[model samples]
Target: MAKRLSLLLLRVSLGGLLLVWGVNKVVNIDHSMAIAENFYFGLLAAETWLPVAGVVQMAVGLLIIAGFARRWVYPIQLLLNGVSLAAVIASVIDPWGWFLEGTNALFYPSLIIFAGSLVVMAFADQDQLALDARKAPAPVSWKARRDCGQ
Candidate 1:
């Protein structure tokens, strides 16, 4: 029960973070473009693609929150968050700007989010609260497999 609840909380929080960022990209495209320019080496800055990307991200976020299709959605979320973490690694390493010039304490949370996504991916099979859990086959004990002869 505790594990399920913990996974549910992590999933909802990470999904909510993605959803909010997606909405920001769609509603405040200029801001999104500026972030891309500043952190992502100007990638994802095309005005035409911003809203479309936002919609796609929103879908992925919703699927994550619902714990549906985790096999695919978890990887997508992990990759996206991984990229985000990479973009802000400097900030995470030097949030106070002790040595890094452009570091900001605000971006440090990306590290935590990335770690949470990793946790979700690693323990996905144990997430009984996931919508697809019912569809997954029960795990076979090692003893049972041994008894079955290879």
Candidate 2:
């Protein structure tokens, strides 16, 4: 019971953070684009795709919180985070002034949230408080039922 509860809490917390970040993309689009600038390249500009990205992120977050399909959703989320983290890392060639310039505060918090996502992925199997928890009824034996008179 405790394990299930802890797993649920972690899932909820991680989902909530993603939800906020996703929604923030839509609500404060310019800020989002600024952050997404790190990922921008070729035709993948934030201005052209941030809203769609926001929707996908928000949906993924909702599914995580609702525990719809932890096996699938958790992995998808990990991939998403991995891509974002890679973009951040790829963009920053040096950290000489990442702190003094005040970028660490944002980047580090994102790294922590990414860490939380990792924890959620690890415990996804123990999830109990979720839509997917509805177990199907066991197969009923017709012979046994008839012998018992309905």
Candidate 3:
């Protein structure tokens, strides 16, 4: 179905994005530290936060790609994306300069990812091509439910 295909594409693409971003944070801690310094990530030192946050980001991406734990994974991913988006959006003192300057690349891309995160959360159930689907049990009859308790 077109719906399934679309959801699949979104899921996979977002997963890849998260994975890469996470790895980038880990690999380039100095860069992440610099960004964090101004982006409300000042609570913790970059050396302590970036790698740990990177691991969480990588895990969220892996779970989204795996598609086996939508009930929990999707929400966590949404929270992560929402926080990141808010930070980036708030950091831009000059909104109109998003495209005019080289320093503001993340402004729009992060917006795109934030929107994608919402879309992914909204249609997480349509992911038929996921691990959860293959592992799910068959639907039970009403009679079975009644017999169990109703």
Query: Which candidate number has the best TM-score?
Result: 1
lDDT tens per residue, model 2, 1-150: 898888888788877767887898778888887766645452334565777778888988899999897778888788877766665652243344544442333454456666778987776655667778765577779998899998
> Candidate 2 — what's its lDDT?
0.72
Q: What is the lDDT of residue 88 in candidate 3?
A: 72
lDDT of 1 at 46: 86
- Tens-place lDDT per residue, model 1, 1-150, is 889899999999999888998998899999999999999999889898888889989999999999999999999999999999999999999999999998999999999999999999999888888788765677999999999996
Writing each residue's lDDT as its tens digit, candidate 3 over 1-150 gives: 898888888888888888987898899988777777777557444597889988888998998898868788888877877777877774344556655443464475777777888887776666788778654587999999999997
- The Cα RMSD of model 1 versus the native structure comes to 2.9
Top-down lDDT ranking? 1, 3, 2
What TM-score, to 2 decimals, does candidate 2 have? 0.69
Candidate 1 weakest lDDT stretch, 10 residues: 129-138
RMSD of each: 2.9, 6.1, 4.5
RMSD of 2: 6.1
How high is each candidate's TM-score?
Answer: 0.89, 0.69, 0.75
